[model samples]
Target chain A: MTLGLLVEEAGLFSTVQDLGRQGFQSLGVPPSGALDPVALRLANLVVGNPPGCAGLEMCRLGATLRVTVPSLRVALAGAPPTGDLPVLRSLTLREGEVLRIGRVAGGAAYLAVEGGFDLKPVLGSLSTYARALIGGFEGRRLEPGDVLPLLRHTASSRRERALPHPLPAERDRPLRVVLGPQADHFTEEAFDALLGEGFTVTAEADRIGLRLSGPRLAHAGPPEIASDGNATGAVQVPGSGQPIVLLPDRHTVGGYPKIATVITADLARLGQSLPGTVLRFEAVAPEQARIALRRQEAEIAALAARLHET
Target chain B: MCAQPAAPPALLHDPPRLLLLGDAALTVEFAAAWSPEAAARVRRLAARVAVLAAAEEGIREYVPTLRSVTIHVDPSRLSLRRLQAMLRDLPEGAEATAGEATEWCLPVRYGGEQGPDLPEIASTLGMAEDEVAELHTAGHYEAAAVGGYPGFAYLTGVDGRLALPRRASPRLSVPEGSVAVANGFTGVYPATAPGGWHLLGRTPVPLFAPDRPGRPALVMPGDTVRFRAISPEEFEGLWSAFRDGRADPVTACRAP
Candidate 1:
């Protein structure tokens, strides 16, 4: 039997997101997806779906889900929607049921699919960040009483399957960054100052970017740079005298001075950090960053492969 | 036939180059300076590149920004070096022919509660509020891009007279459909969110609605926009009509 959960009491910022919708940024759309890719992958893994399967990314306050399927294996990760602490709660969902999650303690939660959620993949992806208004539930956040039509799967689930172990959450620290092609845009001391100091993640943070409140880093001169392409980790410093770390939903180009970019491997870590979670920056070379990312990707692939086999 | 490594390197005019940003992405650089010619080239290259990347697996996503295109591929099925090789085979430095775009006459209600900063903006420009509204609606603007926020179209070609700096402190929430101007540009807020741009008026027309047939974002890149001033009474009538599902926006526009 195959079925999907009906969303009841959709929490603060719940949306159906996947790895991210790519290839549309050039059209001026940001790739809004799961903030914590690893957790999203694991959640999908637990449900015996592909790592890139579409799932719900519940932020701050989690929502209540009524399982419409007779039997389904569901796993919880990240800060449980609301007041639901200690991510990694696994349970067998009964047909015509309700699961209420509390305010997330750390970041966001990932709910995976068994054979992958049977949602229409727009441009080959299913993560809904709602900023671009493209993927998941018609390019908007999940709402109360929304019916999620599940994708049917041939693989039968073995009852009482052991829940996957929890991943060690990296918290409240300086995020590591790699030096950029434009590191010369800032003074030597300013570049160095980024690594040594602590920055408070401001309340102004969102899927588009995370603004930091800290000591002003001095630029070489008047900081009006030409608009250029940006990536997820790029740390852009605009005229406001504050540094903002671009995220998945960030704009494709900007005129701000990008001091550094967080490594791809550490991006998932930065995503899950709660607002007010103090973060610092550590500079790394591009090669080192790539190697680190490759290792993480390999681990994720292995986990995905194992879960899918079951 | 695949071009050989023996092929002589083309002299870098605008220096068509591909840079590996991370493990899963690469950026095709167009130009260092911002110009129409460069922007046109970017649009062309981005369109072509998107076509090429569309069928290519392992290449998860590709987005075209203002001046560059970002390609996001799966590292497991593809590698940074291999993706670079594929791009090298692509024709670079290609020119683009400009195309005609759709035009819209966005109706807005200026001043009073709808536009909170209309008086302040008018005071700053040494003009009456009505004069400012008149100037804003007179210009036919180009939709440079549909980013910054979803369904938010950054319109260009606003007259310099109406240009003003962004507010020192952005309001916590600028009402949806608020027509705003900052730094010589004007855009309408599709949804309510924090904003710094100076408000001029509000439109009842929905710029972004997920439930709509188009699924949010009424305007796309390469579209044209013209604002029309309306009275508060007219605004209320239109607002209620749309709210009650009586208004059907005439979208007689498309990318040409």
Candidate 2:
């Protein structure tokens, strides 16, 4: 039987996202995906879906969805609701029940449903790239009156559950980075300026990237490099001296000189950082970055194992 | 001059310099200069890398640009050092084979509402609007790289005389399929996007159609592009045919 949900009131911005659209960078396709992948995986797992299942990623004020199916199971992660509602826990809604998500405490949140979204993967992913007008539901942000198809699910005994481990709390620690493919392009003073001072996330931040306002970094030589591939969390400094932390929706290639790359483990924290939040950068060894990433992965696996045990 | 013989591959005299683009990707740059020889060398290296990627585990994808190839990898499955070592072992100056690239003839409607900057561009270059269009149509351009926007090909090989710098203030939105020129390169905007390039014309054919099967982009890196001017009436006719699925924006041509 077919199942679905109707968006009652679309909030600030909501789009369906999965792990990413992979293997298409050569064609200049951006890997548009969930900004907070950890939260997305967790939310999906809570709903008994695979980690890469497509889910709704909401920013700021979240959307209100009405269950059109006989019943629907869902889980929320990342930003908690400002209201008394408990999140990061699995919950079920009856037919005609409305799920209201309030303004995000942080920057974004992920809502995953049981059996995942019933959508065809574009270029092997359901992630939405609004700029290119591809992927997701109708290749655009969710709005009122939009109906989303849901993968049919069989009723299960375990309808509700809570995460064994609490979601990671937002910390004020410095964002760790691994210094560069183009570190030599800048003077030592530039490095000092980059790491020594603080940067405020500008209002221009979005799924594409975060523009930071901080002390201007001085280039020792020409600022332009032969255009090269850009990575998620690549800290690129253009001629303006302001750094841009690229995200999932960033262009595949860029000409700006990248001074550092934020470690994989810290990307979730970066994703949660709201505009006006001050951030500091800390340089770490490549080995340290890898170890941190492995640790996070291990934690995720452990969480999944724990959930299965329950 | 609309169709020229494919450039002979240049022998890689100097070893490519490799730089780590974070832990997940590495860039192999052949030369800093933008020249046919440099582009040829980069393409050859990219081909070699593609073979390695297919044979080896952990390599995700590779993007070939004007003078370099960037290979993305899974760090957990493959170490940066090991991947670098594998690349170092590849044979240097491998003779590149010929007749592998495809040539595409794209139809464009010049001047009028489609291209508002045509007169300004022509006057600035001391040439008539038709002369500007003719010069643009004459050059056989190569797809240097496809980026900046989805399916937007950074084409090279615009005639030196028709080369123009980007506008001081970029247009808020350039219409999709607008044929533009800037800094010795000619390209077609795959979608409506903000751009600074001087628009000379617009093509009814979509450069990028995600809905199309097989290849979503009409042109990829290393493909040759030739523009043929069409009358406004013909433009409308071809556009309708394309919309109705009777005509394709791209057709295959054997490399000469």
Candidate 3:
């Protein structure tokens, strides 16, 4: 088989992504990529692909893929939709084999192939930002009957490698944030509400942002600021007072005053949080946040280390 | 690509403040309001940062806006602490490249179906249609920021008299190349999308083209932009020229 999988069913909000499209935000292109980047990395490593290889990012619902390539190494990570496709385990799917990935337990899941996709990079990225219809598998999500170009075929080996799930135990902890590039624009009461309250993720969540319904974050004035570069995970409190945690697909520049920004270490944890899930925020110093990020990186590196033992 | 240290640049009254935006990004904030002074600093900082990011592999990307520039880096390659220290040491006299900008004079056909809200805009401001167009052409605009969509530059420096608020209800589809004004800014909707601005006209030239050879954004932030009113014939000719790939808009519109 020349191509990878023949999609029998296209899941809700499924797209081909890598880390993200980079160095293009100045041109107003939002960097769209895998919601759970850590999962994509782990899935890639387990499948013997580069940690930042392109893979399918499925949210909530998962697609049913029929293997088209003669033989390819595959693995699912980050809240695998179905028990059949266990998290962090690699499997070799041959031609005519059907893999049914059902519903995700959390916000999103990733399915990685050994050599990644044969799709071209746009502006130096394999990530798909469908709004502009740029990059990755025709610059859009996969559809039924769409032939996904698989880059390389792996020799069929019976050795299936796996790693223990690492994020589950820390899932319930509050997501850490670094207080602002615009914290002074918000009121003290706003900070109290943001730190003390548990915000429930609303149905309006997407790769763009997670709309949170929590205590209102009152602004010092009308929620206005000179449009500035928006950092990923910036908790922007607009006139509605609802805090929308900006995600990978967020606009590069924003006019609203940002209250606080979630640390990079907690972004994957935040990504896995599904709608109706209550999440709390904790502000940490940048130094502590760096330490947390380093720890998370260590965890992934260690996971990669255990891959050989499996 | 290094920072030039001739002298401190003008138009900036306060020293830029460096603020952390999580563990990966550090925003260099120039000002809090939308003013020409802040816009100049934003443009100057973007020029320097682009040079620095290219020279240093550690810095990942940087997004420039009207008031700030957010620099992203992999913490492993460049820690936030190192980035902060580097910026603190960067001499702020990079405005030497300020005058080296190309002014794009885009052609637009004003009024009629070409600009549905032009009549309303003129009436709202108590001016005649030609008077409105004249005032619009009289002012200079700079691409202070590019957002909302790819190549959609947030053009600042609209004439104060022509300033108007956006519509309460946005139009479902603002035709591509639609030039509009709202809240003291003039922006051209690069791609047809939901928009709330007051339509002034539609430009024949495109702002964002994927196949653009040199840069992604045609009217990049810090570039100057000027609008020229054209007849229906001129509009039709330029529009088709751009659409059918007869004339390259970038080469045609860029002032020598």
lDDT of each residue in A43-86, candidate 3, tens digit only:
98788788889999988989889887788888998876755667
Task: Please state the error at residue B246 of candidate 3 in Å.
Answer: 3.0
Comparing 2 and 3 on DockQ, the stronger one: 3
What is the iRMSD of the candidate numbered 2?
Answer: 1.4
Candidate 1 chain A least-lDDT 10 residues: A153-162
> DockQ score of candidate 1?
0.25
Q: Residue A214 error for model 2, in Å? A: 1.6
Candidate 2 CAPRI grade: medium
Ranking by lDDT: 2, 3, 1
Docking category of candidate 3: medium
TM-score of model 2's chain A, to 2 decimals? Answer: 0.95
Clash number by candidate, in order: 19, 0, 0
lDDT of 3 by residue, B147-179 (tens): 868899888888888778779999999999999
Error of 1 at B107 (Å): 3.2
> Highest DockQ among the candidates is held by which one?
3
Q: Tens digit of lDDT per residue, candidate 2, span B1-256?
A: 5889865446433667777776777777776656788787678777777778878788988888877888888777776678899888888654335336678888889999998999998888888999989988898999988888888898998898877778899999999989998877889999998999999999888788787786688888888989889999988988788879787665522233
> What is every candidate's alpha-carbon RMSD to the true fold?
6.4, 4.3, 3.6
lDDT of 2: 0.84
